[model samples]
Target chain A: MASNTQDAAHGAAESAPGMPQLDFSTFGNQIFWLAIALVAIYLILSRVALPRIAAVLAERQGTITNDLAAAEDLKAKAVEAEDAYNKALADARAEAQRIAAETRAEIQVGLDEAIAKADEQIAAKAAESEKAIGEIKAGALESVKVVAADTAEALVTALGGKADAKAVAAAVADRMKG
Target chain B: MEGDIAQLGQFIGAGLAAIGSGAAAIGVGHVAGNFLAGALRNPSAAAGQTATLFIGIAFAEALGIFSFLVALLLMFAV
Candidate 1:
């Protein structure tokens, strides 16, 4: 194994090229190329891509924040609108109740006046009827007295006796007293 | 026949170096897997950690690339 390795080593040493990465001869060139590549990439990213991405990110953040604030404002406005609506509803209800009470009072006043007027009319009609009845009774009594005097005088004349008018009147007056 | 031993050793060394690539791949997988686990656990925080996830992945992948470069050097330049 040692002989074989020595022979392999001798063969490899005969050739000039070995691990090219380790070759000091090309290090300067590799470093120069690497520097150029790094600078080019840095310039492209800094000048173009990075700034645009940053601007876009900043704009997106701003938009999100503004949207949140707008939503909050709208929420507050909604609450305010609800409160106003409630207040208006309460006011309308109260006004409606007041109007209803006022109308009820008006109706009550009108009803009371109507009843009083009807009672006064009824009482007046009753009094007038009572006066008329009393007059009719007085007229009937006077007629009955005159009729009795005539009937008594006619009976006495038919019987062939004198019938004094004053006497007949006195007798009728006594019967009426009973 | 005389130089075959040296060539064999170089091939063997390149093969060994290539194993590092698989190890690096495992490291990259670990980074991605952990990031996914964390992201799934707290999805709300996932968006903010995306840059960190990518940085982890890039570092793991860079190691794998370095291993591959070493394998290539062993095979061709050594």
Candidate 2:
């Protein structure tokens, strides 16, 4: 049985010519090193590097989200501020218009009052001038009557040497009547 | 010994090529998935970035295809 096993092994070795014997010991060593390398790589990635990288990435994502939310809030606030500004501007415009209208009305009233006062003053001055003219005309007419009566009495006195005083007076009255 | 060494070399090369192709495919898939997600989120930006995405995929696929070609050459032509 031992001889048979030896012959079988030799035949198997001879079948693949120029093939070296399998080095199981070397294969084992290669496998052990490969395993060590793989484990080291895994440990470095999982325990040392990957955790730190993950933490950094997570922090970056958190910062990004917070910035986006803050931007949205700022946008809302800007819209609110813009709305308030527009409302205030519109209110100011309305107030200005109202004031303008009131000022215009006041100006119109003042102008009307001034015009009425001027008309009253003109009417009073015209009435006073007419009254003054009437008084001057009456005084001039009375002075002319006195001057004419005195001249007629002097002429009658010069022409009535033989006439009585009562007759002369009666003649003057008759002439004045004629 | 020479024949055994040659066979081992072939096996290692084939394994490396296979692993390289698999990794390239996974990397390409990840890039594609992210591109699609970004495109869906912003369709307007998708049009501008489409050419770049395709270029990146082509480059990765070229590497994977080259590895396959090398494996085929080693297996058949060699």
Pick the lDDT winner. 1
Candidate 2 docking category? incorrect
TM-score of 2: 0.42
Q: What is the TM-score of chain A alone in each candidate?
A: 0.50, 0.51
Residue B46 C-alpha lDDT in model 2:
97
TM-score against native, each model: 0.51, 0.42
Top of the candidates by DockQ: 1
Task: State residue A26's C-alpha deviation in candidate 1, in Å.
Answer: 5.9
lDDT of candidate model 2 versus the reference:
0.74
Model 2: per-residue Cα lDDT over A66-155, one tens digit each: 999999999999999999999999999999999999999999999889988988888888888878877887676556555544555666
